[model samples]
Target: MSEPTPTTCMRCAVGCGHLQSGREDGHGVAEAKGNPEHPTNEGADCQRGIEETVDPGGDRLTQPLVRRGGELQPTNWDTAVGVVANRFIEALSNGGGDIAVLGSGQQTTEAVYALGKLARGGFGTRYYDANTRLCMASAVKAYDSAFGSDAPPPTYDDIPKADTHLVWGANPKTAHPVLYRWIAESAAAKDSQLVVVDPVETQTAADADIHIQPAPGTDLA
Candidate 1:
């Protein structure tokens, strides 16, 4: 196996950190090990998350392609960017309201922030949305109910220091193995309470100090 090279996993929007290297047995395989020091995951590795890191990026585009002569052709970055800008300028000239952005869920926090800025600040468009609005609706609602804002105040660093960890409607054990590891380790070290509230008893509920399973669609309805 080649020496493990530290790399960031872009499998999901979480952007977990991991060490990737070649297979030791010369089997042409790759193994990914989560980095314990990463603030995001804290050394958690879900089976699916690790599996994505091993993919060779099949059919993924490496460069910009522009349609030319009735076919898409690889072009330089500057040319490709200019083409897009010109199209956007043309659209804006007609009406900025015509432009809209529906951001993907497979984006980092920084990417989403930038997209928001471009959509609102740059384009001055009100027609903007993100997949997070659909996928993270529960988290958003919880945050709003708790803090009157759709953003969490506590960082991951607060996990280890807290006397109690309450995971609501989240199954970190399967969905976020690294975060589950962090909570489990912290609770074990400090004898802290680990409460999990979900509609179903999941792997996370199995690990929690307390599991509260409300009827499906009945929590805070």
Candidate 2:
């Protein structure tokens, strides 16, 4: 293959850049590589990015499906579209135009934007939010309150330089092995302490300088 388009993974806050290669159908194979230009990654990829790849699945549909006679099958896209369209139309016609849409982190920015527009413009709904509201809402609130926004204070390089490294809540050995390597290597560099805190003991916990296993529901304590 020749060269591939460079882009970042939107899956997480790490936002590691990736190299995508394949045909023009948009379902391209991807891999995580170093992004020399990216200030944070600077040519490194965590496990999440390394294992990421193109979806072998074909183009997806937003249309609804109906089940008839114990079998689920595709109905007329137009009728399905019209059902939603008429529902929204009736909702607006009835002056009950409060609509809301749940967006997603996995979707590209354009898809999210279109969904937002559909809610606000098409349905006149102002209550649109992504499912991340449940996943990262608290973290966002705390980070914004402390750091003034979603800005990440530490880059991937900064992990190696921290004298005190704490691995809490998340087990990076299985979740993000490449990033966990940085922590392990940094701890081995002398004078740096690496601590693992979780409810369950994992491979990473076994290798930590200190492992604290809190009893089940007492993780927050």
lDDT of each: 0.81, 0.71
Error of 2 at 119 (Å): 2.0
- Clash pairs (backbone) in predicted model 2: 34-43, 35-43
* Best lDDT among the predictions, by candidate number: 1
Candidate 1 has its poorest 10 consecutive residues by lDDT at: 22-31
Give the top-scoring candidate (TM-score): 2
Report the error of model 1 at residue 221, Å: 4.3
Residues 1-221 of candidate 1: C-alpha lDDT, one tens digit per residue? 68877767876655678887877766433888788887686676677777766765568786899999999999999999999999889878866788989998877778999999999889888888997776788889989998998988877788889988898888877776766777888877756888988999888888888889899989865
Compose the digit string of candidate 2's lDDT tens values, residues 1-221.
Answer: 43666877654555666665654544456434656676555677764565545543456664467566887678888877776677778777765356667887777777878887877877777678885585578878878887897755677878878987888888877776656777888988888888889888888888888898898898874
Question: TM-scores, in order shown?
Answer: 0.63, 0.68
Off by over 4 Å in 2: 1-3, 10-12, 24-52, 56-72, 75-90, 95-98, 108-114, 141-157, 214-218
**Shift of residue 220 alpha carbon in model 2, Å:** 2.7
Backbone clashes in each candidate structure, one number apiece? 2, 2
